[model samples]
Target: MNKVIDINADMGEGFGRYTIADDERLLDIVTSANVACGFHAGDPRIMGLTVEKALKNHVGIGAHPGFPDLIGFGRRDMSLTPLEIKTDVLYQIGALSAFVKASGGHLQHVSPHGRLGNLAVKNREYAQAIVEAVLSFDSSLIIITEPGELAVEAEKRGLKTAVQLFADRAYNDDRTLVSRKEPGAVIHNQETVLQRCLKMVLEGTVETVSGSEIEVDGNTLCVHGDTAGSVDLAKEIKATLIEAGVEVRKLEEWL
Candidate 1:
C-alpha cells in the first residue's frame, strides 16, 4: 500500500492593516493549515477568526512563523542572530497557540514561512534554534520541514518532525526550490503540477533543474494557498492523491 501523506497550506496571512491571500475556499480541500502570526501577516483578530474557521472545517492547525517583514509578507530574507530568530519564532508560535487552545483546537505543527523556511533547511544552527523553540513551547507540536535538512535536525534534537515537500514549486539541482525571483520557479500550470506531484508521491522521486532525478521523502505536501489557482490546485491535488489510493490526512493523524 502507498504510504499516506498530509496536505497543508499557508493561510491566515491577512493582517489588520493589509489584506492578502485568498485562503478560505482552499481550506476545505487541505487537511492542515499553517496560520501566520502577527510578525508575518496576521493580527489577533485574524488569528482568532482563522482558528474558528479551521475548527469548524475540522482542519489541522499550525503556526506559520516568519521574519518581521510585512512589506514582503516574510518572503524576503532578513539578517538576524540565531538568538533573535529563536525569540521571534517562539513568540509567533505562542501567539497562535493561544488562539487554537482557546478555541478548543490543538496546534499540530510549525511550518516556518518564506525565507526563514529556506534558511532552516540548510543552516543547522537556525534549524536547531527553531526546533528548540518549537519543542519548548509545545512538546506535542510537529515540525514540518524539508526532508533532509530541517527534518533531520529536528529529529536529531528529539522533536517530532514531518518531511514536507512542495507540489507547486520547482526544484534546483540540489532539490532546494529554485529561487522565486527566477522565471520558472512557481508552477502555475495545473496539469504539470499534477503530474509532478503524482510522480513525487507515487514514485518517491523528483526531477531537478539539472535534469537528474533524486529520491525524496514526502510525509506531507504543501500547496501555497495564497498563490493563483490555489483553491483549484489544492482540490485537484487532493482528488488525484485520493484516486491513487494515497490517504491524505492531517499531520496530527500521521504523527
Candidate 2:
C-alpha cells in the first residue's frame, strides 16, 4: 500500500485593503486550506474569495479560528474562560461556514490558529472548549491538531481528528511547537524544510529542538502560507512525497 499524506496551509489571512501571503498561488500547491474566520486576520470579502478559490481548486476548506486579537495576529496568549473560548470558536466557525456554503462547498475541518492552537495542545480547559465548539457546530467536522490534549479530547468526544505536523516549525520534546520567539523556530531554507517533512512522513517521527527524536503520526503536513517561498516549498514537498511512493491528497479523502 502506498503511504498517504495531506498537505495543508493556513490561508486567507488578510484583512480588507491589506494582504498577507499569496493565497491564490498557495492554493494550487496545497490539498487542504485552513482559512481565517475574521478574528485573527480575515474579513468577509477575503473569506468569500478564499472559499471560492478553494472550491474551484477542489481543495478542502477548513475553519481557522483564533483569539479576538487582531493586533497580535492571534499569536499572543489571551486570558479567557472556557465558555468564552467555546463561544468565540463557534462564532468564527459560523462566519466562515456561511462563505463556504455560499460557494457550494462544505467545511471540511477546524484548526485553532496561533495562540489558540498552541494553548489547545496542553491546556485542558481550552482544548475541551475548542472540541466542544467544533462538535456543536458539526459533529462530523475533523479537528486538525497534534497528539495532545486537544486531539485526545476530540477523539474521546467521538469527533474526527487529524494529526497535523508542521513542516517549517521546530518542535519541543513534548511534541508542542517551539515558540516563534526562539531562534531557528521557523525553518526558512526550502531544502531543510523538505527534508524535515520527508522524515516526519516516512519515518513516523520528528527530531525536536533538543536534538532528540520522538514519535509523530502526521496525517497532514502543514506549511504556513505566511512563510517566505511557501508555495515553492509546498510544491517541492508534494512532489518529493509523490516521488517517494506516497499519495498526496486532501484530508477529507481518507479521513
Best by lDDT: 2
After the best TM-score superposition of candidate 2, give how far the Cα of residue 37 lies from its true spot, in angstroms: 0.3
In order, candidate lDDTs are 0.87, 0.92
Candidate 2 residue-wise lDDT at 166: 92
Per-residue lDDT over 1-255 for candidate 2, one digit per residue giving the tens place of the 0 to 100 score: 888999999998999999989999988989999999999999999999999999999999999999999999999979999999999999999999999887788999999999999889889999999998998899999999988899999999999899999989998998888889999899898888888888999998888999999988879999888888887888899999899999999988997
Report the Cα lDDT for candidate 1: 0.87
**Candidate 1 per-residue C-alpha lDDT over 90-131 given as tens digits, one digit per residue, 9 for 90 to 100:** 999999989998999888889999999989998888887898
Q: What C-alpha lDDT does candidate 2 achieve relative to the native structure?
A: 0.92
The weakest ten consecutive residues by lDDT in model 2 span 225-234
